[model samples]
Target: MAAFTAADVKALREKTGAGMMDAKKALDEANGDMEAAIDALRAKGLATAQKKSSRTAAEGLIGLAVEGTRGVAVEVNSETDFVAKNDKFQDFVRKTTQVALGLGNDDVEALKGSAYPDGGTVTDKLTENVATIGENQQVRRMKTVSVGQGAVVAYMHNAVSPEAQDLGKIGVLVALEGDANADVLAALGRDIAQHAAAMFPLALNADGLDADVIERERKIAAEKAAESGKPENVQEKMVEGAVKKYAKENALLSQIFVKDGKATVEEYVARIAKEAGASIKLVDYVRFQLGEGIEKEESDFAAEVAAAVAG
Candidate 1:
């Protein structure tokens, strides 16, 4: 028989947040050795992360951070919204965004492989978090934006706290290029970032818009034109006009400014530049709305209760 007692199992469960059966099994496997049991539980936790990976993680927070002229936005997803409110989860999101800012690249896989502040690799820490938090968590996506001579500003929508403004439901980073004064650049960049968070533009400009998206728009426009029974030449003109309008509406620079609605984003930047007496260029931007494209699994609480009773 294993040498460990009931108290050991309880302690192991408290330490690792493993199920009672899992804790007892690990303790038995370790032959009452506490450290060995911990190692076993950690290994099991890694396995648990793998098992939970297939579960949809469509709720959580978008974390944003800026350092000097560089900024990063990250989307960390949890299985439920409740997990997003967890202090530990918020801390992890904040720290992960900070780590991402240092990386200087927007690669999520590389960020996961990077060292975490507390101890292990970021991926390892995430696995441990899943074990402790009792839910699947994912570092879904990350984006970094930087300007060589200007500023990268970050903005968070639905901020949880004024102090920790980086944790929120939506995050935006705008990179402005030019030799403007630091204060002026930061102010302009913040405004642009805020606009980005609200507008959710598909690209910085029409030229930067996705080719497939343009093609899809073109196809839809052609179909619409066909329904009008227009001449072939007129239909061609109509399709081209429709595609251009779609691009203008979806691209950041061409989109109407959300603030005053009197000017396009490009015009707004030009106006800001003239006022600041500097040539400011809207170089790039990134916006992340938490779980924007993820489809969450729908649960039927009544059915679940019925099944439990039947079982």
Candidate 2:
């Protein structure tokens, strides 16, 4: 049996909506013959999955799952919202989230290369899906959160499909460090994560604040301080004080609680820790807003229609 090259596998996969491994299997079974591989896929009825892969998959689902001491979140994109509503697409999202949780890596490329259930690598499966679905789909991003003694809680906002389980467009993961029970910590975590999504804090604490961001603020503060016409030393002190205020405002632990707008986040977490009888440490968190930086291609629908008619 001849070994199939990547191009051979890709071409076979494109012809039959089957995964890369499946395509290779077919190709190998066919003795590296492309037509034979297509016939092999047709016999299996999985060829359609390959045919649909070329279509754009822009609208899909964000999936979240929590098990044991860890939680995972994943974003799988499809070409249309209709596909997102499809049970098949939803299942893909769910499975992808589970795969992401197991990998425990934040890198998208790594996750794509990670093993997928039912054979073949995730990348291979995605390629087959692209061909089968007839749309350009993507595994956009993934993240996992876990702790030694604590719980990592997750919340998905505005679930249009069965995907978004909690709130709006924001998905968050908050890690609490302590021996807290999953149920109790999860409740608190959801609230805190939701707050984080709403507030968009810059860092877990003042110490973790970005140095460049701090410097930029310092420059702005110095300019503002100079406007007061104070002495050089006094202006310097004022600028320093201003920088401190800026840090307090942007840093997560220092930000005032959004719910009550009274106590700082640190104080609030302290209160929770006391109530829970476990020391809680805010290790880190992640918040993702759909299409945050991706600039969508803008187009005029009417012009498109006119062009189609003219053609």
- Candidates' RMSD to native: 2.6, 8.3
What does candidate 1's lDDT look like per residue over 115-224, in tens digits?
99999989888988997878999999999888888888888889888887989998888889997798888787778778888878999999999999999999999999
Off by over 4 Å in 1: 1-11, 20-37, 302-311
Highest lDDT: which candidate?
A: 1
Best by TM-score: 1
lDDT of 2 by residue, 1-311 (tens): 47668899988766555777778888888888788877777656544545555544446677777777677777787766666766555666677778888877788898888888857888777765655554556888877777787888887777763634732256788888887666777777877888888888888888989999899999999898889999999999999999999889888788888875898877888888889898887787777675555555566889989997999
Instruction: Give the local distance difference test score of model 1.
Output: 0.89
Model 2 residue 235 lDDT?
96
